[model samples]
Target chain A: MIDVQNITKRYGHHTAIDQVTFSVAKGEVLAFLGPNGAGKTTTMRILTCFMPATEGSARVAGFDCTEQPLEVKRQIGYLPETPPVYQELTVTEYLTFVGRLRGITGPKLSSALDQSIGRLELGSVRHRLIGNLSRGYRQRVGLAQALLHDPPVLILDEPTVGLDPKQIIEIRELIRSLAGSHSVILSTHILPEATAVCQRVVIINKGHIVAEDTPEQLSARLRQSEKVSITLKTCPPDCEMKLRAIPGILNVLPGQAGGSFLIECELGRDLRDEIARVAVLSQWGLLELRTVSMTLEDVFLRLTRHEDHLSEPAEATVSASAERTDA
Target chain B: MTPVQAVIAKELRGYFVSPIVYVVGAVFLLIFGLLSYLYVGFAGAQAIQLMQMQGGMAQINLNDLVFRNLFASMRIVLVIILPILTMRLFAEERKLRTFEFLMTSPIRITDIVVGKFVSVFLIYLGLVALTTLVPTVLMLFSDFDWNPIWTGYLGMVLLGALFLSVGVFASALTENQIVAAFVSFGMLLTIWLIAGLGNLFGDTTAGRIISYFSYMEHYDRLLRGLIDTSDLVYFGSGLALMLFLTHRVVESTRWK
Candidate 1:
């Protein structure tokens, strides 16, 4: 439903987004993962036709964003980072204005307003001025405004930034429910949000697409080295050397507690059994042994860090492995 | 409803909801009342003096003596107050970050500009209409040629429209409302001062051009009951130019 092709946005000499490209199929939820100033909002603005890209082109619902901006705008429901709301307008008034701007009128407009108010749970504050509402209510009103038109494509920039934890969960659930009917492109810096609510994750850094894959696939690809935590009743003097001597084991480090050790090994290698056998032979009581998997946060950090080290030619092999893991 | 109509309605609603409208309206009415009271007092005193000299009721032209001067003062009052009415039209949108919503919507840039201009013009019209009460009360107490009074009002409306357009253009140039008001005031004052420069040139081609650019010259003719098409064209084209410039500024903002 959306295709962004090699789009670059520059403010004078400063390039906000450079040669960025991505697409979202119908009903697919794509998370634009990036830190602050990673051009996420810039890309969203381009796709929503808020501003034209300095180079390349973007198409939404088969209409070019710059050439046929009205059509593209008609297809998109955008929630900007600051929630584009009038402080003096009540919730109903704001929604009605937005609906009219979208060419909705009469019974259709009122029904759409009611539906969105119900969906975003804004019915309670529908009569109150937006300036008087709390932050959470204001964010919901912003979401409701976006959904008022029922466009096939939704471009939300940082949709869950200011909500409390419970509100965050409710918003995530709301976004999840939008899948399979609306193609959603939501930008967020929060890693867990992407993993929990998105079907595909695109990690962006410094205006470049650093990595793109399913959340689980990204985690697995970055975890080329396995870690195993082992706790013992008593540590033998030679325990470290013994664990290091095992085949395929790369390194050993002390764990957080006393008499606990973390073992590292290459991928596809299981060092738990070997460590347990060695501990039994050395008369060191084994209390715990388990392999650790990489979290999405770890994967995001690895990808961004790898992007930062592009000048180092030797690390090409690690990136090559990441590409190989994509298969 | 069309986008332009929707924007106008919303903007009018916004104006009514805020206390700015009431305060500005009350202040304008108070200024009009004071000016009218003083004009009436002076006209009354002149009539008594003429009666004492001629030993009969003196024939005083209220429209010439009072309404003309009243409108001249009103022109200056509008110059000061109209900017306050228009400063928030675009500057507040920028400050509040609602410009994003406006530009991203399916509406055209012309709709946004025209809609904002019309809303403020209507508020100014309402203010001008309220001042009509002064003339209406004056009509009850004296007989004067109604042509000049009607013409004076027409001049005020045209001048108000032109000033409001400039105010909108100024607001579009900045995100600060106070700065918008000052810039608008400066622009209007410079145009008003152009008539002063016309005197220095004194009948030269350059003098005629400068005088033609003076809004006061066109407004003065209309106030004197000379309904020339040239003056109408001047105010009409001036309003169109300012609104067009405002539209360009708003459109360029998207590119930036």
Candidate 2:
């Protein structure tokens, strides 16, 4: 459990995070979705008590981070962006150090170490020096260090940044399996990671929380219009104007192919029936037809970047919707 | 392990793994050994010449002839080499970003600072203790009072503790090890040089007070086996001051 209330962090005149407020319930995995330098790491640092916020407060496990850092730290297992590991230490040695630092010892320490190493699948390289290991393995060692203490809260900053595709999938599956047992707050720029593993997403940009919702709800909330994409085999010179003249059709734009057209309509309106009837009466050869919904990527781009991002060429929307099924 | 003991163990393990400790230790021992050998040879020649000139086995006090000078010469060696040992203590952690790991943990800042200081001090102690082997062997072949030799070692220990405190303070100021080493070197050199300037005043109260701030007088007294409480107070207060300043720097680092 964590609660951050209007915490602002400023380094002189430059504010890293401004009045950011968010909370995580027990066993809920929250995604901190943001691009680079978007105050995600800053918020996490304030929560972890590495640094105090310039104003306001953050509490972890009912203890104030600034005033009761030791207690808050006792509840948290943090994996910083760079994976704070000693290069000369072996994986098992490093984990043992962390475990002892956490006050776990004897059989308990070994069990915690074994459980974390097994979870991260680091048993093969346990005896190898961390500096000699590959970056992915080092990252996994970082993960193992954080998990070894088995704290109530886990704050991971870009946990899957350097892993391979299979490793990424494995890490995502591991995070997904942590639900209902760990309160995980993972920050990542990769939108699919949030979609795959998180129960709630908090999108931060320029030191502000731009949007916060479930993955599906985030996309649905940002949708200003619905779209219908159709491809006609026959030539249609006046088809664009006719579709624009329709009652609920917002606008008609070019689709992928030559005879293809994209029709934009008001939100929550499924104009497929009207489009189909018009295609039958006009006999404009309906080769293929489908409705396009905005994807999480489009929602992210719209909220973080220029709001008019989605209203660009219809091809952008088409590709965005095409990416939806990929996730 | 307790928080402080765990950090000390980790730090000691770190020193042994790095090449800095071995290189610095070898150089320190080599200097001690070479100086001890040269003093012994020089003492032997003096005794032989004295016998040839006037007498039957003229007196050559090894403490005055060898151990005193040996201990004096080691001040320079410790000032130069000790910084190399301590430069990486806090600076390397800052550069590697492991500082965040330590700070975010449940350990107190004082525990970490004291742990690192004691760990390096133990390594230095081991190196200094190794030099005692030379005197230990010399004692078997000759007769000399052991009091001054032990006091000289006590002087070296106090002087080194002061040097290491300054080193820990300097290392806390920056993330660059070379810069840390040099800053400490400059500070120690400047403090030692203060005594030279104080002598310009020649027994004036200001000169006496200024010279008292430097370590040379107290260390000299200890080297001669005087063991005054003032000298002990001087080393104790100096070490405490440096450690307190180091604690402040470490505590303020999280804010920065």
Candidate 3:
């Protein structure tokens, strides 16, 4: 539903985004992962028809951003970084105004407002002034404003930046539930958010796409060390010390579960046999043991590091696989 | 509602909710009342003197003595107060970053510019309408010609509309409301002063053309109850020119 072909945006001597190219398919959620100043917002701005690129073209819902901006804007529900809300207006009033601006009126506009308010859980605060709401509520109001029109395309920039943990999880679930019908391209610096709600991750750094793949592939490709997670029935006093003393063991870290340990070892070593032997000989019953995968955090750090970063931008679309980050 | 009408309605609702319009409206009505009181007092005393000196019957023109001067003084107030009403229209949108929301929406630049212009113009028209209470209350006491007073109001409306268009244009030029107010104030003052420059040139054709450019000559004709086509054209063209300039400034945001 969206395609950007080699668009470059420049401001005088400074190039904001240099020859950037990406696309989001219908019913797919693409995570635009990058640190601050990685040109994420700039790219979204061009796609939303808010501004034109200095070179190349961006099309949304098959309408050219520059030439048919009205048509392009008609098909987008954009939640900018700031939420674009009026502090003085009530939630319903603001949404009504937005609905009218989008050409939704009468019964259709009210139904859309109810759906957005219900989905974002803005029912209680629908009549309250936005200025009286908290930061998280205000953020939800922003999200609700974007979803009010129910457009095919959703471009949200840092949608969960200011929400609490519970709100963040709820927002992620809401985004996850929007997987089949809406084509979403959300930009964020949070690594786990990408892995949690998005099927594909596109890591950008300093205006360049360093890596683009399914979260697991990017993690597996960047995985340089082997990690083993073991849960035991009873822990010994010198268990960590003994695990560190084992040859080729890179590091020892505490696991998430009770009486559990995460052991890192050299890439090619079979640490499972050695770990099970220690558990058997030391009379510690092994309850669970499994090799842990590298996280999106590791992939993010590995790709963003300039010393060995990809000079050529990663090409094509990424698909499949989902993993949770334990970090 | 259409997009333009939606913008106008939203903006008009916003004006009433905010404190700016209440303050500007109160100040406007107060000044109009006080000035009318002073003019009526002076005109009444002169009429009394003329009647007494001419055996209880004399011709004292209230149109010249009261209203023409009243509108002349009232327009200077419009130039000051109308900008305050319009200063925040575009400036606040830019400051609050809602300009992005508006620009990215499926509306044309003309919709925003015209919507904002009409919204503030309506409020200005309402304020100008309130001042009619002054004339209506005076009519309760004695009879006077309402023709010039009505024309004088027509003049006030056109003058306020012109000032508001300039304010909208100024608001588009910057993100600061105070700066917008003062920039428009400076522009309106310059246009008013251009009439003085016309005086310096006397009766030359250049003088007439330069003087015609100012709102003074056109508004004066209307004050005398003379509804000339040239004056209407002048106000219409001036209003359009300013709004067009506002449109250009708003449209230029995409390139930047």
Candidate 4:
């Protein structure tokens, strides 16, 4: 479990994270999505107690990060961007050392080391020095070190950044298997990776959380309402213009169906019945009719760019609604 | 393993695997051998000096064979060897970025500093112990006073300990081994000069205070089979101060 509130990191005049606030529930896998320089790593560092936040407070496992750092660190495992590896040590030696540092000992330490090596699939390179291991193997070693103590939370920063596709898939599968047992907060700019492993995504841009929701909920929230896109098989020449002239019809734009139209209507108005009446009277067959929707990517860009309300009829009517409210 | 034991074992293994440790030991042995037997001509000079004496060789005075060789050997060997041993103690770790892994681990800062210092100190001890054969060889051929040799060996080990501690502190302050070596040599040189610089004064209390600070002046008395408590305190205090400073430096790294 983690709670970060009003967290802002400023280095001199540059702000890395701007008043970001988010929390993760127990055993939940929360993916932090952001573009480059979007402060994803900075936030992860704050959560892991690797770096103090410039402003605000963060708590991990109910322990304050700044005030109770050691306790917070004791409760969470961190795989930094660079992995924090000792190249001269063997995989078993490295994990054993890490386990000892984390207060594991004797049979517990050995068993933990064995489990980590087994889980991360690092058994082949257990006796080989880390310097001779490939990038993927070294990465698994890093992950194993973090998991050796079996901490309840894992804070991984770009865990699969430089790995090949197969390695990435393997690492992802490993992370996916940690779902119910460990609470994870991973930051990555890779959209599909987050979608695959995370139940909820937090899209951040310019040091702020632009949107946070399930993928489907985010997509649904960005869809336009009371607007239907209609494609006609055979329509009159001025069908789109005619649709625009109908009462309660706000706007009509020609679409790609040769004689299709995208129609917007007044609030709480569904003109599908009226449009069907007009289409039948005009002897024009409706081939397909559906509402226009936005994908998660569109919602991500719109919210991050601060343009979410710009094209919404709700926004227009709010000026119109504010004007209406004022009237 | 406990953090302290884990750190100590890792540091010792690092020393065992590193080529620099052996190279330093070989060079130290070579210099000790050259200065003791060939340059000073320990065997030939003694044979000639004994033959030239009118007192029927004075039975090859045991004191000269044991005391003279160890005293002379230490001045040359320790001065050259300690800097090489301590130079990379912390500097190499920093340059390799392996220190970051150690620092960030849950181990205490004191454990790391003490572990590294002990490993390097052990290397110094091993190198010093290897040269004991010079005295052992002399004992086989002549009547030698073992007391002075023991005293001299103790003083040299203590001297090495003191120098290594200062070098450890210097190494912790920088990532460049060259810089650490030079800084340690400079500090050692300053300690070596303190008594002579004291002589420049008109024998005031200030002058005595300055003279008492020189490790070599006390080391010389200790080499002559006399163990002054003041000298013991001087070297002991100096080593303690450096170890403390090394701990501070190691701790300060976390803040950075």
Candidate 5:
């Protein structure tokens, strides 16, 4: 479990994180989403007790990070962006060293080492020098190092950054499997990574937490209107007018394909049935009708774009959803 | 294993697995051998000259003529070599970004500093031990007092340990190994040159204080087989001070 309360990290006149706050319940996976320079790594560093927050407090596994750093460190498995590996040492040697540093020894250390190696599938490269391994293998070794002590919490900063697509999926599945046993807080700029592996998403932009919620909730909350795509067997000049005349329909625009249209309706409105009935009555010969939901990527861009406009007072009230449907 | 022990073990393994230990070790032995050979040759020539003039056996203290000078040369060699040995201790960690891993671990800053200091100290000790073969070979050919020889070795170990702490401190000041080496070299050179400043100032109060700070003054006393408590205190406190400063530097880095 982790609790961070209004932690602010400042460097002279620059604030890396401004009153940013979030927490992860035990056995929960929280994705930290932010663009580059969003202070995601800074926040994770403070939570891991790697650096002290200029103001505020953080606790991991109920141990205060600053007051009880060693205790907090004992319960955390951190994989920094650089992997924190010794290029000269072999994979097993590096993991063994990390295991010992965490106070795991003898039979327990051996078992933990084997478990990490097996879990990360590092058996083939176990005896190879880390410097000789590929980037994907090196990343896996970094993950293996974190899992060596079997700590209850994992704070990984972009764990899948350099991996290939298959490696990314494998790591995603690995992190997903860790949800019920280890509370994970992984930071990444990749929107789909959060949707795939994390239960909750915290979107931070420019040192501020812009949004936090479940992925679905964030998508739904940011979606101000519904969109429906309808395809007709034949095109009519009045098709757009007919769709716009329907109740709750805001706008109807031609789709990229011929005889198809994209309809925008007011929030919480279902125009599919009405459009289908109207098409049948008017002899429009409807071929397909489907509702389109906003993806997590759309929600992320909307939230970040909204934050970007906070500096311009007059345009600040222009809702992200309004701009989306109008565009 | 304890955290400190684990760090020390890992550091030592790092030293051995790389070419640094072997390369430095070979160069150290070569320098010691050449210095010992020259000293033994000069001492032997002096003894032969004395015998020829007196028409009898000349009393020559080989330990005085050879071992003392050998250690003095060793002190200078250590000043040059110990920095090379210790430059990577902390600087390499910073360069490779492993300092994050080390600092974030559950270990204390003192443990990291002390572990690094001790590992390098042990390697220097091993190098010093290898030079003992010079004395062992001298024992085979001549008889000499062991007291000064042993004290001279004690002085070398203490002085080398002191130099290592300085090297570690210098290494902590920067991520560049070359800069660390040069900074430590400059620092030790300043300390060594303080003895000359003492000579220039004579017996003035300022000169006395400066000379007291000179590591050579304390080391000279030990080389003569006089192990004063004050000398031990000087080396002990100086070593501690350097290590403590290194710890402070390392701890301060986390805040920055």
Candidate 6:
């Protein structure tokens, strides 16, 4: 379990993380989504107790980060953006060192080391020096180090950043397998990765939480209007006129829908009710009727744009519009 | 073993597994050997010539010769060997970005600092051991006493430890290994040369402060087989001050 309460980090005059707050329950996977410089890594650093917040606090597994950093560190398995690996040491040696630093020892340490190696599929190159390993293998070793101590909370910052598609899939599967046993807060700007692995997503833009919900809920927010496509036996000459006369008809746009008229209107207006009324009154045969739904990608773009607009000052809008050019 | 011991063991293992440790050791031994051999030959010949000219038995005081050689040899060791021992201590960790992994662990800051210093110190100690041959040969062939040899080495260890501490502290000040090495060498040189300036100035209050602050002044007195309590206190306090500063620098950098 992790609770980050209004944690703010400031470096000189620049605010890196501004009053950011979120919570992840045990066994829950929370995806932190943001573009570059969105305070995602800053937030994860606070949650893992790697860096103290300038204001407010966070608790990992019931231990306050500022007050009991060692205890918080004990419960966290953090993989920083660059993996924080020692290039000179062998894979096994590096993991063993991390294990010992976390107070793992004797047979338990051996067991944890073997388990992490197997989980991350690092058995083949366990003894190879980390400097000699490929980038993907190095990333796996970094993940293996985080998993060595078997901490209850895992804070990974862009785990799949530069991995190939296959490595990304492997890492995604690895994170998915860790879901129910370890509470994870994975941060990445990659939408598909977050959608594929995280149960809940927190979208941040410019040091603020723009949106937080399940993938389904976030997609729902983008569905302000639903467009229903319909195929009739004939394209009626007065189709737009007839549809506009119906109640709850926000707008009626008629177009060739597979050789029939297409109807687009407000969501939940059930233009289906009004379209049925108009069609029956006019005696036009209906062939196909389907409502178009918004995808997660669409929701992401809309929310990020909306957040950008909301954060912009009114004076900048005019100058931005005047200087803007279309290519 | 205890946790601190476990950290120390792992640190030592790291030192041995990497080429940096062995390279530093080899270079230290090479320099120590060449400098001590040259100092012994030159000083032994000169002492024998002076004793012959004074109508003595041409059997120079080998103890005096060893004391002079130890002091001369240590001057070069502190400049070159001390930097190699400490350049990579904290800077390499930062360059590799492994400092975060190490600092964020459950181990206390003191443990990491102490463990790293102890490993470097052990390597220095091993290098010091190799130089024992010069004094051993003198005792075997000539009438050199072992007291000055032991005391000189004791002074060398203290001076080396003090220099290492300063290097360790300087290493913690930056993430660039070259910068740490050069800065440490400069700091050691300033302290090494300040006593000569003190004698040149002669008895001024500033001169007294400079003399009291000089690392070589205290070390030179100890190399004469006389362990003054004030000199002992100065070396011990200097070592403590540097180690404490190193710890503070390391702790502050943990967050950054």
True contacts kept of each: 0.81, 0.70, 0.66, 0.30, 0.77, 0.55
For model 1, the stretches where C-alpha displacement exceeds 4 angstroms are A280-285, A308-327
Which residue pairs clash within candidate 1?
none
* Rank order (by DockQ, best first): 1, 2, 3, 5, 6, 4
lDDT scores in order: 0.89, 0.89, 0.87, 0.78, 0.88, 0.79
- The DockQ value obtained for model 1 is 0.84
Candidate 4 per-residue C-alpha lDDT over A247-309 given as tens digits, one digit per residue, 9 for 90 to 100: 998877665446666677765677888887787778788776665544455556566654556
Model 3 Cα lDDT, one tens digit per residue, A33-127:
88888889989999988889999889998999989999999999898888788888999999999998889999999999999999999999999
Least well predicted 10-residue stretch by lDDT in candidate 6 chain A: A318-327
Segments of candidate 5 deviating more than 4 angstroms = A230-238, A254-261, A274-289, A308-327
Model 5 — TM-score against the truth?
0.93
DockQ, cand. 5: 0.74
Clashing pairs in 3: none
Question: What's the C-alpha lDDT at position B108 in model 6?
Answer: 84
Q: What does candidate 6's lDDT look like per residue over A1-327, in tens digits?
A: 899899889988899988888899999999998778989988987777767999987988889998998898888898888878777778888888888787788999899999999998899999898889888888888898888887899989889876889889999998999999999999887888888999999988788888899988887665555556666776567776787777666654444333344445766776786687677778777766666555565556666665555433233322222222110
Q: Candidate 1 on A1-327: residue-level lDDT in tens?
A: 999899999999999999998899999999999888989999998898888999999999999999999999999899999988998999999999999999999999999999999998887899999999998888889899889999999999999988999989999999999999999999998888999999999999889999889999987776657778778899978889988999999877776578877677988888788888998999899988877766687667766766665444323433333333222
Candidate with better lDDT, 3 vs 6: 3
* Docking band of candidate 5: medium
lDDT string for model 3 (B1-256, tens) is 7888899888988999899999999999899889888998998898888888887767777778888888999878988888899999999998988888898888889988999999999999888888889888878877779998898998889888899999999999999999999999999999999999999999999999999999999999999998899988999999999999999999888788
Model 2: lDDT to the true structure: 0.89
Question: Considering summed lDDT, which 10 consecutive residues are worst modelled in model 1 chain A?
Answer: A318-327
- Which parts of model 6 are misplaced by more than 4 Å? A227-264, A269-292, A308-327, B1-3, B47-57, B204-206, B254-256
